[model samples]
Target chain A: MARIVVEVMPKPEILDPQGKAVAGALPRLGFTEFAAVRQGKRFELEVEGEANEEVLDQARKAASEVLSNPVIEDVVSVHWARES
Target chain B: MARIVVEVMPKPEILDPQGKAVAGALPRLGFTEFAAVRQGKRFELEVEGEANEEVLDQARKAASEVLSNPVIEDVVSVHWARES
Candidate 1:
């Protein structure tokens, strides 16, 4: 089976409280170098055959329409997981 | 500023209900090509200066110790965002 990866991130203009929380905790945990953090979603979709152009297209369509909320998140990428 | 991307995924033996829910919904939404789905997390950590070796090392440490629960998740990757 081929695995397709879809990544979704909060829009730049949107507030990400989860990311902010993580950023705040990092220093306390002794990881002091990072300036900021943004949390996003990653999805792996398994298909029966190759992750061909057609499957990638379908994955992209699914990413935008079903996996992410257009009002707050952006579908940043959709590609074969192995390539990543 | 430079960004480091960290990816976390559920262990292969771990049950991912969220991913299963999304997989179930996909067929109902008319995108029937996918056979299964697994959900994970992506983190973007911003740092000042270059994303050099030292910064990447810190990101890798943070990815495992703070960003993911070692009991259930794995730090799949830690790398410069631009390269991804």
Candidate 2:
């Protein structure tokens, strides 16, 4: 078994109020010094069967199609991690 | 400048309908090899100044205090990657 990690993030042009909200609250919390922050989604898929190129290809499809909205979001990448 | 990544995941016992929703939709879309799926938050913090321990520590504090909900979510880890 292996794991596929799909990272879905909002397009750069899209306004991320959630990230901004957290960024705004950071300085107040005394963790100042950061210029910007972007919040996105991380998906962990536990593959029960084989974790091969076929699975990787499907994972990529799932990442772009099911995990993210191309109109508003950008899937940074989909990669395989060792099964833990 | 550097980047700080904060990964926040819901507790194991917590219900993750979003992840389940995605997982449910995947098979319909022809990606049906995963046993389970979990979705969480991935935060990217771009630091303007040096990416030192001080900055890393501050980033950790920001990650835990502002980026994650201690009650329902668990911050998996905080780490630094090369500035891109």
Q: Write the per-residue lDDT of candidate 2 for residues A7-39, one digit (tens) a residue.
A: 888898999999998888888888778888999
Superposed Cα deviation of residue B56, candidate 2 (Å) = 1.1
Model 1 lDDT tens row, A1-84: 789989999998999999999999999999888899999999999986666799889999999999999999999889887744
Task: Give the 10-residue window scoring lowest on summed lDDT in candidate 2 chain B.
Answer: B75-84
The collision pairs in model 2 are: none
Per-candidate local distance difference test: 0.92, 0.85
List RMSD in Å for every model shown. 1.7, 1.5
- Model 1 clash pairs are none
User: Candidate 2 - CAPRI tier?
Assistant: high
Tell me the TM-score of each prediction against the true structure: 0.95, 0.92
Every prediction: chain A TM-score: 0.93, 0.94
iRMS, candidate 1, in Å: value is 0.9
Q: Considering only chain B, report the TM-score of model 2.
A: 0.91
